[model samples]
Target: MTRPVRRTRRALQVAGAVGAALLALSACSSSSGSSGSGSSATSDSSKSSSPKVSGTVTVFAAASLKESFTSLGKEFEKQHPGTKATFNFGGSDTLAASITGGAPADVFAAASPKTMAIVTDKKDAATTPITFVRNQLEIATLPGNPDKVSSLKDLTKSGLKVVLCDKTVPCGAAAQKALDASHLRLTPVSYEQDVKSALTKVELKEADAAVVYRTDVKAAGDKVEGVEFPESAKAINDYPIALLKNAPNAAAAKAFIELVTSAEGQKVLSRAGFLKP
Candidate 1:
């Protein structure tokens, strides 16, 4: 009886080994059937999850928006992975002229609605312009209030070398409106081409005071002291942004505009002294 039991145990072990070999062959055949299918699925998923977008997007923005826009452009590139943003920062009117004159720009951000209107009226914009921020003028003077230019009236004092933006730029236009409303005439030593330049003149001590956007003065930090004047309330400027009619990369342009109008972007602008539109 013991010999018979041992023979039965051996037969069971051999049968188990034969079953395991058959199962291994079955798995190999099934894997061969799907050969490249699993890898193809993984490749498809990767491609869909993160599409590669590579190109340089040029943004033409107002001079007052330089610091904030520069930071925002860097943030945008980080969010989009492979996309790059190149900015051309200058006077709103000058940037508008460049865009209309066939400069390759994916986006245009103006310091004033009037400047944006110039592009929209000519149908040079791809979409309707959106006002993203509002800014007002301030008197930027030498640090520690050396000029004693406390109000708009002080700008008219004799022998005070004042600097103002040319009428073509938004800051200049706002300054002119404010001065006109105050019934005061200010003859600056120089008419700067842009707000940054006007602020620079004051920072360099070349001009006693300059009429520029409040945001510009804030961005300059301790370089120049900003003097708030009541007349600035009468000349608030609205900033607008839009995609160019012939943007080289429309999708990326739209994405960048959305980011700028987002909460994070607003915070950056606000820190630079811009008011949300």
Candidate 2:
């Protein structure tokens, strides 16, 4: 009777131990499954928080867009976290040449379609270029109009000391076309490298008058006075924007383009005197 009682006691103890071991195994499996599910949820939440777009977007833009583009770039940064804009502002022709030469620019904004054509012609652009803005020429003169430059023809008057952009620049090319349409020939004292330089000459009173974009004159503010020329209508230039084919940050490039075409971007451009395209 004592032996039977001991065997019964041992059997109860073994059964209890086995039950405890099963419970421990079950708890561990449940904990592991819960941990895995929690990890997956965290990963999903991180991915949905924001589109991961980061890197520098280099842009080559025409000198005329300097102020407006600079402002737009700042606003773009606020909209896109971890993104930066780098601008190379200069004559449109020069900028186009740089893009074609593998300057690693993400986007090119040219003052004239002709300048953009140079890039598209070479197939250096990634997509079809779109017209973003239009600008017309204006006669920039000294604050008081001391030389009395009234029109395009007035530039031809002897001793007027006119200044014009070099033919390689967009403004210079448009000025030539306008002059040809008006059947007027004027010899400037100096051919400036860019519109800003030509305007600078007029601002400093170094030149009596210079043909520049209306936006440039607006940007100059009190530095110079702008005289509207009727012939400017015939020489209007359209600005185009496009992504470069070899852009290092293609995603950032496309995002920048979309921002420029947005309503906020247009307002900035309009404030700078650029006509909507």
Candidate 3:
């Protein structure tokens, strides 16, 4: 071949090699991009399916949460190996006070938003408090409802011994609102510090009846009878929960909160007689 012909053939060979190289690079890039996308999707799926959380999470919750929360704590521990859950249950206001007083708790679950407000107002909550459940008041009477207390007005019956939660607590506040709505005046034998205590009085026959939470009555089982009153609708308490600002186990606390708000958690609360928020 002549020199010109040989030069044209060499140019064509070089162009083909460059084109092959470019195509090879493009293929590699496409493969890399696809792999990265798949990896990211897998990572996200894994994260959502089995979140990684491990630590000791301390939760301060209302007295009514004692049973359901205790069960959730055990489930949390089981789901996250190397993690543990500890709970402090009491009156909502008292628990809020403890949290605001610098208690090293990871989470706070109150029976009423009013109680949770104390923490949020003090900037002790990591985020806005969210209502997880609601509760209504019920007249807890002796087994068989011996006194036949059917309504809030029945509690005002002459000479009937009754107990009530102190007005500061959520149950008490609800009870007072209910009574006020019914335009009824009830004179209780005594005022207990919490719903459980008030229910305990009736369970022990210390009083004929007590205005307490419906959940408390259910928890008391056959020991007490629950009398649903119409006025209770006007005084339902919204139970709020949140992670503390200074949580010692932030990750675990978040996980616990998620579990509590999950369908499974709601089921447990419903079984305990708590209404969903």
Candidate 4:
């Protein structure tokens, strides 16, 4: 072969090798770009599934839900950084009244459907209230049931200092239904504004016994003992929760409600002695 011909062929081969290397590099760059775009798509999906939520979520919950709701609220704040879950624990009737009276609340969890209606009727609720759990009435007596108050009628025994929740409250209304179902009539020493208050009376030894929700008795944790009556079945109350119409933080409020109704939240409620709705 001539020198010039050999040199030309050698240069062409080198140039072809360099062009092949560049093509391979181009393919790798294109593949990496496509992979990055897919990763971006995945990130977008994740953000949609867990939309960013922040700010304070004010909740008005029934006194019976203090333990479970508070735990769920903490979980929510943990899941959503830069957020606060505040609660107002009180009688369902009182809470309903407040929600209807233009009180600023993100959520309202009532002890009964009737109390929820108090807000729904006035169009104060942004969403229809859903029952998350059901609560049954129980007679809370001194530790170890000192009074031996097992039956609803036992509260009627002479010299028994029993407390009942105010009739306007869900616990009180349930207690009344159970008492009426058993055809029993007993006068309570006091009518507390909420179930917790009535249970507190027994816990303080100020009252021998009180008619309250089973959850309250469980929350008391040996401070008071629970006595289940068959009549309680006749008076199970359904607890309902809803987002408020004028919630200052609607996005956060909705997210909080979703967490409460989620499986994790239900587990917490179940652990707290609440029944599934």
> Any idea what lDDT model 4 has?
0.93
Give a tens-digit lDDT track for model 1, residues 1-277: 9999999999999999999999999999999878778889889999899645567778999999899999998999998888899999998988898888889999999988899988998899999999999998999999998767889999888999999999999999999999899988888899988898999898888988998988888989999998999989999999999999999988889888999999999999999999879
lDDT of 2 at 135: 93
In model 4, which range of ten residues has the least summed lDDT?
A: 144-153
**Candidate 3 lDDT, tens digit per residue, 16-44?**
99999999999999999999999999999
Q: Lowest summed-lDDT stretch of 10 residues in model 3?
A: 46-55
lDDT (C-alpha, whole model) for all candidates: 0.91, 0.91, 0.91, 0.93
The candidate that wins on lDDT is 4
Spell out the clash pairs found in candidate 1.
none
Looking at candidate 1, the ten consecutive residues that score lowest on lDDT are 49-58
Residue-level lDDT for 184 in candidate 3: 86
What is the per-residue lDDT of model 4 for residues 1-277, given as tens digits with 9 covering 90 to 100?
Answer: 6999999999999999999999999999999999999999999999899668999999999999999988898899999999999999999999999989888999999999999999999999999888899988888999988778879889999999999999999999999998888888989999999998999999899999999998888899989889998999999999999999999999999999889899998999999989999
- Looking at model 2, residue 262 earns an lDDT score of 90
